[model samples]
Target: GATDADAAVAVAHPNIALVKYWGKRDEALFLPVTGSLSMTLDIYPTTTAVRLIDEPADVVVLNGRPAVGEAYTRVARFLDLVRSRAHRTEHAMVVSTNAGPTGAGLASSASGFAALATAAAAAYRLDADDRALSRLARRGSGSASRSIFGGFVVWHAGDGDGTAGDLSSYAEPIGGEALDPALVVAVVDHASKAVSSRDAMRRTVATSPFYRPWADSSEIDLVEMQKAIARQDLPAVGEIAERNALGMHASMLAARPGIRYLSPQSIAVLDAVLALRADGVAAYATIDAGPNVTVLCARADAARVTAALRAVGDFVDPRTAHLGPGATLVPGED
Candidate 1:
């Protein structure tokens, strides 16, 4: 068994995909239809502590409980991948905590997997950069491929073959890539989402007629979003992101056993955002597998956006909304 004192900890934040990744071409490798853009949030993230133990019973403890069975298998498989390059080492005990709600449809898995990959790599003294660590993290969760880096990140969805996919999977560091730092205002938190992202994507890919169109158009969206980011064009970026997110959800609606993540409150919040845009507010909303909405706005306009959200009924959390940092090691501690 491992003691707390012997553990190495890493902290990483969940990222919101600006260019949403909906359908996957290869389920086993978690390959997406096209590249996705994301920004790591500073407020909500996962912190993981990993320590090597001198026992054969590799174990994982998440939020205080012993992670057994499937969860253990998943983490073990990831560790096995890292161990292939790293020298054979003792089993490890890992404890993970998500700053945000675990099953709230947020990208907790992205940060959780990234933090685990980083802590595991550090605990074993593995020589790896952000990209290498990202590749390892991607094996654990598809969205996690971008969480390995901070600021802005793009995950290039390569060809379906494992080898080609690995080579094509690229993560770019775009934290300061834009001339202006963008701000993401979270409008709602803890809204109940009916379907989990995993289930939604699986169903969408298997049944949605619109899935093919979404996949086909992702390349254009990727190119335009990148250009908008490069130019620091907030309006262009927001337009592209909102459209991409809508496209993703549309596919979900087209699924055989169709389901909608949008709740009455979700639609209300979306309408409010559009109203803000019409009123000349430079803001837009994007959602993922959850009803919670994140608003993309300029850092300077964050206060105004927050005020606008507060003016609405008790549908949003003012405190939970804020700008965030990318995936990084804990200062002074790591």
Candidate 2:
């Protein structure tokens, strides 16, 4: 039997969605109300190691520090899922580190859970294909499903009301080379989010009148975005991405009491992105559940986008990202 001293490690990168996924149809299963499309980025990976132990409870260490509070609970629950799947009662020790700050709306959970799923699955000697692994990652974080693949990926929300089981939701790669682009990440704030994306998502789905519209429009956006990627139409892709992201924010805003993730700095960066477009630089901005903004542009325009964003002074640091690889199990420490 494998001992706690023997660990399995894995690495996975974050992804930014062009077509956003906001609400969940089934929270327990982490099934989204609509499908989403995203590009896995080469920057800011999360490396995780898992070791099954004979202890009574799971242990989690993050970034060289013992994880506590909600973070520890989440990790323990996710490991419980892994243990259940493998039909093993042994608790585990999971240690993970994010290359960048966590919970800054940079999809840290996506990469973290993807890495954890990869490492834990291997450590437990579970037999799962890429699709099954993606589904397993999704149970930890909805966006994590996309991190299981590289390049352009689409997480299908899947069809079912409990009958479809685990197969109902999984992510797969979408083929397209002409539309390969770079993402300019403008880091406005690195602090952990005050209100979790999970809470905001639940509020939006339960109260926002625009929730239905957003879900409906996202379906259309997903189809059109796929076409844009296939044809390598930068303008079409940018337009769809910008509109889809804004629409997602709008839905959240319409929730009861409203959930505003965008800050003044986020808007300022948005202004700079628009100015670059007016100057014939094809740059479009998208944001997640935090104040940071990401600008999508041709790989050749990375410098221009970065410079323009820096000029705005709304971001402390601006970085560039390209298409990244899928999560993988490694023999040694990541």
lDDT of each: 0.77, 0.91
Taking the tens digit of each residue's C-alpha lDDT, what string does model 2 give over 189-229? 99988889999999999999999998999999999999999
Q: Extract clashing residue pairs from model 2.
A: none
- Scored against the true structure, residue 172 in model 1 reaches a CA lDDT of 66
Model 2 misplaced regions, further than 4 Å: 1-6, 163-165, 332-334
lDDT of 1 by residue, 148-235 (tens): 8777788888765787887677566765455454444444657435576777898999999999898777778988988888887889
Model 1, residue 223: C-alpha shift (Å): 0.4
Per-prediction TM-score: 0.89, 0.97
Q: Candidate 2, which ten residues in sequence have the lowest lDDT sum?
A: 1-10
Where does candidate 1 stray beyond 4 Å?
Answer: 1-7, 68-72, 87-89, 175-194, 319-324, 331-334
Candidate 1 TM-score versus the reference = 0.89
Residue 37 error for model 2, in Å? 0.4
| lDDT agreement of model 2 with the native | 0.91
